[model samples]
Target chain A: MSFFNALLEHTFLQHALFGGLLASLACGVIGSFVVVRRIGYMAGGIAHAILGGMGIAYFLGQQPMSGALISALIAAVIISRVSRVSKHGHHQEDTIISALWAVGMSIGIIFIAKTPGYNVDLMSYLFGNVLMISANDLLLIGLLDGGVLLFTLIYFKQLLALCYDPEFAGLRGIRIEWLNTLLLCMVAITVVILIQIVGLILVIAMLTLPAATARLHATTMLGMMILATALGMMITSGGLLISYNYDLPTGATTALSSGILYLVAALIPQRRHAVK
Target chain B: MPALITLKDVSFSYDDRPILDHVNLTINEHDFLGIVGPNGGGKSTLLKLILGLLTPSTGEISVFGKHPNQVRTRLGYVPQFATFDSAFPITVLDTVLQGRLGKTRSLLGYNKHDHAIAQRAMAETDVESLQKRAMTALSGGQRQRVLIARALACEPEILLLDEPTANIDPHHGESIYELLHRLHERITMILISHDVGFVSRSVTRVACLNRTLVCHATSPVDSDSINHLYSNPVSVIHHDTRLSLEDNL
Candidate 1:
């Protein structure tokens, strides 16, 4: 009990709480779209693809987040554009995304090998070190959260149309293509923010799982968003406490906990009907 | 009256294979035009072309004296039943509200008026009872009604439907036709179907297609004309064992 009290009193722990809350909010909102569009795999692909940016930034002796953002954005743009023209459609998008993921990890591995005296803490980036989060990182997260919330509010109608029926949306002048691009951009931004805490390997789990879990219980889009946000907050905060007590990795714990929650939700019995 | 929609020398091909060939069509206001054809005769493709979902390869298409895309907001489309995934998490009311997206501003969320319009549309389609229910939980007939409600929420000048009653029960199918008949007085409609009798009875005009348009005009159509339009030998099968037995004897 004393140890828990000490941990709570720590400033680093406070920063972690604040950052996790912000990150969770961003993921929960943006994740609703990702799950509805069935782009969970694409999100995973983009998250992993950020490693290439991390490698280049490390080689240049700069902040890895900068490189991760730039590289992830570039990968996102390429994936979105290529997915549009590819003969196999979304399958081709997944193929390219997986290839980018492999390339990114390989580049990061090589850069780590070349760098002399690996003094920088790489694990902090991988599993998240919320204690080390600065004011600038917090501000960046706040801005991203605000942007995502605003975008969701502004384009609520159009996004709903795009999600439900693209064909009808096109006929009704919803600008399906532009909305698709905008959604992909939002996913990229969300992934970049999450990579700070969950790392590339596990960030998609945070994005996809909570919304999916919420979907099992909620009948409406708004309900799903609310449930997802609530679930995400629980996972982040609970995982933080567990990590502090057991000295486990926060990202892995949070992701695993969320995944379990999804399974539990799925097993709960209320109504089962074939999808229309 | 000048045609409300016109397609002049319109053609569409996917890869090297042509789906619609040099199709010419004109639809006037308040006209309920039913397009019928074989399984792969491009009935759905033609609707897509008119709705601006697919661009024409060779010619000009106009809706209300403007290009289809330019006037897209004036048109409503209810696509084939297979196009939507019901597993998507959304309520019936929310799905219907999507029809108002074209009229709503991009940044502003749906207002009270939008909600009211969506509710009215659902009521018109007889789906208001299922407003709060999950879409996937509805029956096939109910789902179709919700989709119609969504299309109607757009308040369009023209409504385009691709196989609106394709998978529903006969009762539901009749109800759909009845609904369309009632709505025909207000909005122009283009219905695509494979059932000849259904279209011929309900539509003001009938269009028969086979890889290309064979005929399109006001209906109460003749059987011979439809036979010639389809280019298939019309056969009547009488299930009689007596005829065969007598022939053998």
Candidate 2:
């Protein structure tokens, strides 16, 4: 059945679409900061590290997504601490991020290996099956989305200062280190929401690609976020239709579409100055 | 002039490598002080210390009769223009308004008074016309001016600049110095510069740093003293005329 026809008939399709919308809210908001601050690599590392959480959760016979959430938040805290310590030292931040990334995936694989049953569902977590998004997953995504939006709204100015120039923010008595850690934690939560739709491997794409595309034309952070969110919704819907039509993987199709859209946006000649 | 900032035997090091050693300096109110030094001579590090961005390994530094961090909001800082990411999406007005961050009390964002202050700062720096423009659309000189405006929006008692004219052309550099000179009438200013000639010509006081510091009144500064501090033959320009240290001596 065509995606449009199935969308009318199937509750799962509706849940998947709603999940995409909720995920995009967090993606557009947090992803804007992540892209502007140039922390996408760190965010990517956090996403990859989530597999370790899933692995441990499965080993403990718990919900894998819950494990992913716990793992993401812990990874964020650890990454922020590592970044702070290594910022002025010989030990580079990216080196540590890469270590965590690899270790997390490796641990996940090991745990899945030890699980008694044939853990065929592990594939869905790695490369997400959006069509499998249950109503419970939608509720979780919604709650996370609300938290991300509220936090971003309250601390928008401080976050802007931090992302633009952290030293200046520190001088302003902004408590930049604590704010940075909180920002990372927010990114971690956003990562979990994104993992539901795009899975761990392709999560960074959904997190960054729309924001990157919006950056080409946005004059302000708020504009970039709003534009990125709208673009994200369109991309998700488009990817879903195309995947259903061609019987392709939904997560990969969404990631591929996001990449193509970003490239296309880059190629288009944009106005040099955004409207005031 | 009353002493506004005082550093007592301040020593700082990075990983046991001494960047600054036993440096003592006092800055007075309404003073335009310039700090000039060789590369890696801890000039920038000193400003960071004063801004409370870095703690000293030893010694006491105080601003406004208190710790630097306690008086941080009262002190403005203009970072090197080269260090900025121009491609970052922000408006000139928004960038300047960041100066009011420390004073902003509400979570709803900048207030009417904040906007008024930012606008006044942009006007003082002659960047009011460019307030609506994207930061990326600005030239190097325009960007420097915008940064100055941002610092000025803080309504600071003392403004600290780290190489305000490092990357801009000579013409823009001169204008920036001119703006700083004008601002000196009301605001105490401390700036680090590599251009010894401009420092000597513009500032009321000059401090030459090279693992140690030598303070000199502007009129009494000479190339021989600077060359001795640098431990290298350096050329010092005065009023567009290039003079080798030996010739000036």
Candidate 3:
């Protein structure tokens, strides 16, 4: 009762709650695909790579979020393009992804270094500061959530086909490359939206773990999404509660809570249809 | 009936290493073709070419009088069953519904009509009862049948199956072929396999693909052609029966 009272007393706290739920919504829907496609590393690469975009945005005197979003989309295209070019070229794709991962961080570091009078909010970028989440962040999260929901509602089947059987989807004349590019872009967008809650470093964990934990119990993709969203909300809100009461960092505490929840879920024996 | 698929001097190479070399072939309506070749003999590669997963390096291919990709919706595909991720979180029904990918335009969603086709396909494959089961929980044979159901859901004109039983047990493999034989009359099927005896028995035509094509053009493919396909004539011991498998020289 008092927790709700305290949460309602502050607008920033309310924004954090709203933003966290929206982030959960996006993560649950998109993260399900990310887990099934086994694109965790690539998604992580994109999340980290978005920092380069953020850094560049900072250097270029542009709004950092839009710049980050654009660079992440571009990075998504680059990742896909690189993978496509090397599909049969005897090149290991993991190496390419790793290269991009390093390149993104390196570029971000170099740009941050060159940005004169740069305020060091690297902590927020790396770990996150959900307590400081603003109304603008909430609106951005809401809009992104809308787009993601609309996309899933309209193209759920297409996304399912793409993830389950790419070749079959291709043979169905689905224009797999474009759909794939769109999927990667969504991953990038989801990362952009989530950076405030879990930061770039821990983004993949929240994106993947909730879905992965849900997958053990879910018989269908929709079921997985629903369960994951609920779990994400619980973890996020619970993390927020702990942070508020214990004077901890909101995002890290929330992320740590999710990690603990995953362990607990894992420890729970006899989860129906659990993967071996 | 017009040619359903045509490949003209098609060749594919992986980084300068040839997989298919100067291959030319044509398949017509209602043709049940069994493409048999050794490992790395371009049998799967040929199917990929037709599926438009890879463009031929030096030749042209067409499906239903159009570019392979353009007519992909009319052609059903069953990729190697082993490639499926068992832990993927998809229901059998959801997997089958994916076959309706071509029918549902954006915003239209899957109408009841689409579900009807998927249900019929599931019934045809005798997997209707398992519709709600997760994909990973099914047995190998059940999974393969579900895959066929998915392919059939598209109502495709030509069905291409790539090694449907490569990882299946011998008993289950025959049953899988039996299912294919049942659907043979309706859909023109092209099956890629290394099982000469099975191909010889099941298909209307047997094409030997080893960097080139020499089709038997008849059922019950003769031992002579089998011997030619495999330069070194050999036989297999299958369930106490002597099954011949000739290796390409």
Q: What is the number of residue pairs that collide in model 1?
A: 1
Model 2 in CAPRI terms: which quality?
medium
Residue B223's lDDT within candidate 2 is: 66
The residue-level lDDT of candidate 1 at A33 comes to 89
Model 2 C-alpha lDDT per residue in residues A214-257, reported as the tens digit of each score: 99999899999999999999988888889888989999999999
Cα error, residue B209 of model 2, in Å, equals: 1.4
Residue A241 lDDT in model 1? 85
> In candidate 2, what are the lDDT values of residues B1-249, reduced to their tens digit?
558999999999999899999999999988889888888999999999999889999999999989998999999999986786878999999999999998976667999899999999999999999998889889888988998999999899999999988888899899988999899999999989988777766788988898899898653477688779889887755664665555434
Question: What lDDT would candidate 1 get against the real structure?
Answer: 0.81
The candidate 2 chain B region of ten consecutive residues with least summed lDDT is B240-249
Chain B TM-score in each of the candidates: 0.89, 0.94, 0.91
Error of 3 at B95 (Å): 1.2
Better of 1 and 2 by DockQ: 1
Evaluate all candidate structures by whole-model CA lDDT and list the values in order.
Answer: 0.81, 0.90, 0.85
Pick the DockQ winner.
1
Residue pairs in steric clash, candidate 1? A154-B107
Give fnat (model 1).
0.90
Candidate 1 C-alpha error for residue A193, in Å: 2.1
Rank ordering of all candidates by DockQ, starting from the highest: 1, 3, 2
Please compute and give the TM-score of the first chain of candidate 3 against the native first chain.
0.95
